[model samples]
Target chain A: MTTALLRIPAVRLATHLRRLGAAALVVASVLTAPDPARASREQTGDDDGCARDGADLPLAGAHFAPRRVEGGVAWDARFVVASDAASSFRGGALRFAAPLPAGEELVAAPGLGAIVEDGRIAGLCVGAGARSGRTVLASFFQPLSGDGASALGAPIAAGRAVQIVDTSVGDARLELVGAPLFEKHVGFVAPRAVSPGAREEARRLAGVREDVSASPIYLRGEDARGGLTVRVVDARARAETSAIAVGVAFAGVVGGLVLAARRLRRAASVERADALLASEIDAAAKEPAG
Target chain B: MTTFVTILDIACGRPIPAEDSGRARRLQLVVFALLASLAFAGAWGLAAGSQAAGLAIANLYKVPMVILLSCVFAAPAGLLAWRLSGAPVRGTDLALGFSGGVFGGTLVLAVLAPLVALYYQSSAWAGPLLGIGSAALALVVGTVMFVRGTIRRLPPGAPKLAALLPVVVTLGMQLLTLLQLAAIAAPIFPERTPFSGGIDHLAR
Candidate 1:
C-alpha cells in the first residue's frame, strides 16, 4: 500500500516538471527575438520610449571633409544647426566617432570644439536664439603616423559616424537630416563608389521614397563597386571557326557559288547545244524523204 | 573565286534563269553558312585578345554547332512556309532558301572582317555595335530573299496571301535559330557590353 501511494505522487511530480519546461521555452523566445537596432523605427520623431522629446527642436546637417595630413589623415567636420531653432541649439554639444587609430595623439584647432579624451566634443555654445543657420561645433587635426594605418585602415573606406545631442531637450539625442554615416571622398573623384548591394538598396529605396515608376535600375559592372562595364554576348551570337570547319564552310559557300554560276552559264549552253542537234537531225530526215 | 563572287551577287538578288536556280540556290546556302561561321571565328579571335590563336582553335567547334542548330531550327519552318504559301514545297528548296538568307546576312560580316578585327583590337563598342547591325541587316535581307525566292517557286495559281504567310513563319523560325546561335556562341563571344552607359574609365 505504501509503495503504491508513493508511485502516484512521483508520477504527479514528473508531470509538473514537463509542464514547467515547456512554459520556460515559450518565455525565452519571446524575450530574445531579434536585434533591437534593426527593429528601431524611431525615425518619425514619435515619443515611443523617449524620456524627453528632442524631436522638432532642430534638424542638423553634419559635413565631414577628409584631408591627407602630414603624418596621417585630418577631418574638417562642420555641424550646421537649423536657423529656426536658434535658442534650443545654442548650448547644444556635438559628438563624433573618433576616426583616429589607437594610441595616436589628436591635436584640435583652437577655435574647434574642446576635445575630450576618447573622441567626445564639448565647449561648443550655440548663440542665443539669434543667429540661426550654421554654427561650427568643432574642427580638429590629428597626426596619424605610427598606428595610423590600423586606425585609418583603408582611406577610401566608409566614414566614421556623427552623433548630435541638443541641450534644450535635456541633452536628448537629435536625429540628423542626412544619413548617420557619410561616405567621404577626399578630392575631385568620380561618383561615390557604391557597392552592388548599396546600389540595389538605393534603387529600391528611391522607388519607395519617390513617386516614380517602380522599374529598378539594374547596373552591370566588373565588381560590386559601381564602375560600369558592358556585356556583349546574346542568343543570336555564334562561334564555329576551326581550320577544318572554316574549310568546309568555305567550300560550301565557294562550291555553291561556283555551281550556281556554272549552271547559269550552262543553262544557255545546253539550250543552244540541243537546238543545233535538232536542226541537224531534221535536215537529215528531209534529205532522205526527198 | 570568280564563281564564288558571282554566286554572292546572285544571293544579293541578281536575277538568274529559272533552270539554273536550283543549283544556284544550293550554292548560295553553303556560302552564307560558311561566311557566318567565319564571322563567329572573328568575334572569338577579337575577344580572345592575347589568347586569340588558342581561343580561335578551341572555339572552332562553335562554327558547325551553330550551323547545325540554325538548320535544325529553320528547316521545319521553311517547309511550313512552303506549304502554307502553296508553293511546290520541296524540302531541299525551302532548306536552300532559308540557308541563303543566313548566308546573305553573314556575308555582310564576312565582307567586313578586317574592320571587325581592327575594332575588336582597339575599341570596345565598335565590334559589338557592328555585330548587332550586321545581324539586323542580315535578318531583313534574308527574310526578303526567302519570301521572294519562295514566291518565285510557287505554283502559277497560288493565292497572293500565301506569299505573306511564309514571311511570318520563316522569319520567326530564323530568328529563333539566330537567337539559339547567339546563346550557344555566347560562351565564346561573351557579352562585352550589353548597353552603353558612358565611356568606360579604361577607354577614357
Candidate 2:
C-alpha cells in the first residue's frame, strides 16, 4: 500500500520541485562564487599600520602591466602590487608617461592623491585612466590586512567608489575611476536585491536609478576594504571610444526591451492557460451546465 | 485612485508615444530640476535671509515617489517607441543617449544634493523656490521630452525591429556593467601615481 501511494499521480509535482531545486543551486553558485583571496598583511597599532616611513621603488613581487587605451593618450601602465606593512601605505606606483599636475594631483585622488616629501607611494589609487591626454582615475578600497585597511576601513563586502574626469566637448561627465562605477557608493548599485522570480514573475527585472556624479568625499582610515572587486578596463575592444550620444539613447532602448520580455513571458503563460480552459469548456458545454 | 490605476493600466498595455510617455518622466525630472533650482535659490536665500534647507529636505524625500511614478513610463515609452514609432536606432545612438542621460542626471543630483545637507542643519523655513522650481521643472521636462522624443521617432526601421531589440538593448546594458565594461577606458589617462600621504602629517 505504501509503494502504491508513492507511485500515485500526486507525486508528479515532485519532479518540478527537483528541477526548481537544481536551478536554485545554479543561481546560488553563480552569484556567490568564492571571494577574492585577501593577500594577508600584518596590521600594526593605530598609527604605525605598515611602513615605519615609506619607499618609492617598485615592489619586488608587485604585478604591473602596460596597455594602449582608446582615448587620445598614447598608452598607460597599470599596477596591482602587494607589500609588507613597513610603510604606512600598503604599496605605491604610478604611470610616469602621464601624471596629473601637482596641484590637481592633491585634489584628484580621494584617498591617495596627496604627494609627500619623499615621493614614496602611500594609499592605493585603485583605478587610473587618462583624459585630455592625461590619465586620471582612482578608487580606494580596503586592504587584505587585519587592521590596515584602505582609506575606508574593513572591506565593505559590496562597497564601491568611482573617480572620473569629464572632458566632453561642451561640459564634463563623471568617469568611473578606482571604485566600481555601478555599485552602491555611486548610489545606484544592484544585487542588493536579486531574488528568484515570484510565481507570477514578470519576465524583466527593474533597477533603481542613480546619478553617476563624482564628488571629492572625505573618508577616514576606517573606511576601505570594500568588497573585493576587479574593475577591468578593456581598451583592446575599443569599447570606450564609442560615441557618447549612443550610450544615452540606449537607456531608452533598454527600457523598451525590458517591457517586451515581460509581455512575451506573460503571453506565453496566458496561451497555455487558455488552451487548458478551452478543453475544459468543450467538456462543460457537452454536459450542458449540469 | 481607481482612475489612476486605470491610467497606469492603459499606460502599460501599449507603449505610449514619446511625447505622451515622457509626461510622467518629464514631470519627475522637472520636479527634480525645480528642486535643484530651488535649492540653489534657497542656498542663496539662506545666505541672504531665509532658511529653506529643511523644507528642501522634506520636498526632496517626496522627489523619489515622484520619480517612481515617472519611471513607470520609462519601460513603456521605450517599448512603444521601439514598436510603434518608425525610427532607426543604431548601436551608437542608444549608447550615447543613455550615457548622456546618466551624466545629466548626475549633475541634476549634484545640484540638488547640497540642499539635502543644508536641510539637515536648518530647521524650518527650508529652501524656498515657488517660482524657480516651477519654471526649472517645466524647462527640464520640456527639454528631456524633446531629446527623448527625437530618438523615439528614429528615421524608419525602429518599429519593425524584432521584439528582441528591446531585451537585447536592456540586457546589454546590465551585461556591460556586470562585465565591468561600463568603464572600459578607466585604466589609463592623466596617468596614475602610487599614493599621497595624509594632510596633517604632510603639512606638519
Candidate 3:
C-alpha cells in the first residue's frame, strides 16, 4: 500500500517540491556570498576628529583648460580640496576678482554643495573624510569674451585665498595663481551625461541650452601639511584623437575605393567600345559589300 | 510610400533583397555620405545644445572622423564575416547591406532627435535616457535588418545557424571600434571614473 501511494502522481509531486526547496536554499546562499571588491575608492578618516593646527589643514587647488565654444573660448576650471577629515569643508566663500556677469553661472558638480550668493559662490562642502585624498569639489564656467568677459577681468589675480571655513578647521584658503590660463590649440570635448540624474543635474545647473563641459586636469599639490599630493588632468584628448584618426582613415579608404571603382567602370566601358568597333569592321569585311 | 514601407519592413526583420546588387553598392556611397552627415548632426546637437552653427562646424571635421572610425572597424569586420559565411555575398552587396543597416538606424534616430532636444529642455534626466534608449533601439533594428538580409540571400538549404557566426563576430568587432570611437567623440560620464571617491552628497 505504501508503494502504491508512492507510485501515484500526486505523491510524486513531493520530489518537485524538494527540488524547489533545494534550489531556494542554493539561491539564498549565492545571494548572501561575500561582496566583491568595489570600484570606488575607500573612504579614509583622520585620527583626530578636528584639525589641530596648520599641519592638519586640508589643501586646496585649482587648474583650468581652455575650450573653444561658439564664437569664443571658455575657461573650464576645477577647484579641489585634499582633506583628511570626515567633513573637509562646512561652508565658505569662493572669491573671484571680477564678479561673474549675469547669464553666466558657476555650475557646481553634483554632491559638492555650492550656492551662488551676491554674485559670488559660497556654501562649499565635502561629504567624504579627507583620507580619500583629492576630490574635484567644483567647476567654474566662464566664457572668454563678450558679456562673459567681465566674469574674469583682465589681470585677474590668482593665488588669492579662496576661503573654506567651518567650525572644526576654523578657516582654510585655496590660493589661486594669477595669470591667464589658455592652451594654444584645444580640441572640442563633447559632454556626456551617463546617468539620468547626472544629465538632469547638468542641465539644471548649466542651463537647458548649453552642454556642461569639464575636462579633467589633475593638479598635484600638498595640503598646508605638505604630505599628500593629488593629481587631476583632462585625459579626454587621447580618446578624441583616436576617434578623429579612425574617422579620417575610414573615410580615406572608402573614398579611394569609390574613386578606384569608378575608374575601373570607365576603363571597362572603353574596352567594350574598342571591342565592338573591331567586331563591326570584321563583319563589314566578311560581308564583301557595303 | 513604397520606399517607406520597405524601410519599415527592413526594420521589422524582413529586408528586401537588392534587385541590382551593383547599383545597391553604388547607392551605399551616397548612404555613407548621408550617414556621416546625420551622425555629426546628431552628435553636435547632443553636445552643443542651442548652438546651430556648432553643428555645422562639427559636421565639417568631426563627422568625417567618426565615419572613418566606423569604416575602419566595421569594414574589416564585415569583410571577414563575408569571407567566413562562405563568400555568399559580393563585396558591394555587403557594403550596401551594412551601410543600409546603419542608415536605417540613423533615420530612426533622426526622427527622435527633436524629441531628445525637447526632453532635454523639460527635464535633465530625460535627455540621457532618451539618447541611450534611441541608440539602443537603432542598433538593434539596424543589426537585425543587416543580419536577416544576409541570411535571406543565402542559397536554399544552407544552415541558418552558420550565418549567425559571422554576424556575431562582426558585431563584436563593431562594438570594440565604437567604444574606441566613443572614448573620443563623447565625454566620459563624470561619475563612471575608476576613482569613485566616497563623497557622500547626501551629507549636503
Q: Highest TM-score among the candidates is held by which one?
A: 3
Indicate which candidate wins on lDDT: 3
Per residue, candidate 2 scores C-alpha lDDT tens digits across B1-204 of 432232232222323323222333323322333223333333322331223444344333222222222333243454454455433554333332332332243334445545534553463334323322432453364335324533553555544344335434443333233223213322211111111111211232
The global Cα lDDT (0 to 1) of model 2 is 0.31
| Among all candidates shown, the one with the greatest DockQ | 3
Please tell me the TM-score of chain A for candidate 2: 0.17
Using Cα atoms with residue i matched to residue i, what is each candidate's TM-score against the true structure?
Answer: 0.38, 0.19, 0.41
Q: After superposition, how far is residue A26 of candidate 3 from its true place, in Å?
A: 77
Q: After superposing candidate 2, which stretches have Cα over 4 Å from the reference? A: A1-290, B1-61, B90-99, B102-106, B112-127, B134-204
- DockQ of each candidate's interface versus the true one? 0.08, 0.03, 0.10
RMSD of 3: 27.3
Give residue B64's error in model 2 in angstroms: 2.9
TM-score of chain A, all candidates? 0.28, 0.17, 0.27
The clash count for each model shown is: 22, 72, 24
Per-residue C-alpha lDDT of model 2 across residues A1-290, encoded as one tens digit per residue? 98888787667888888999999998887677663211122121122212333344232111111122222121111222223422333433321221221211122332233322233222332222211111223322222222111121111111122111111111121223355323343422223222223101211111111223322121111122232223223233234354233334444444544454455444434554566577678878899563
Interface RMSD over true interface Cα atoms for each candidate: 10.3, 15.6, 9.6
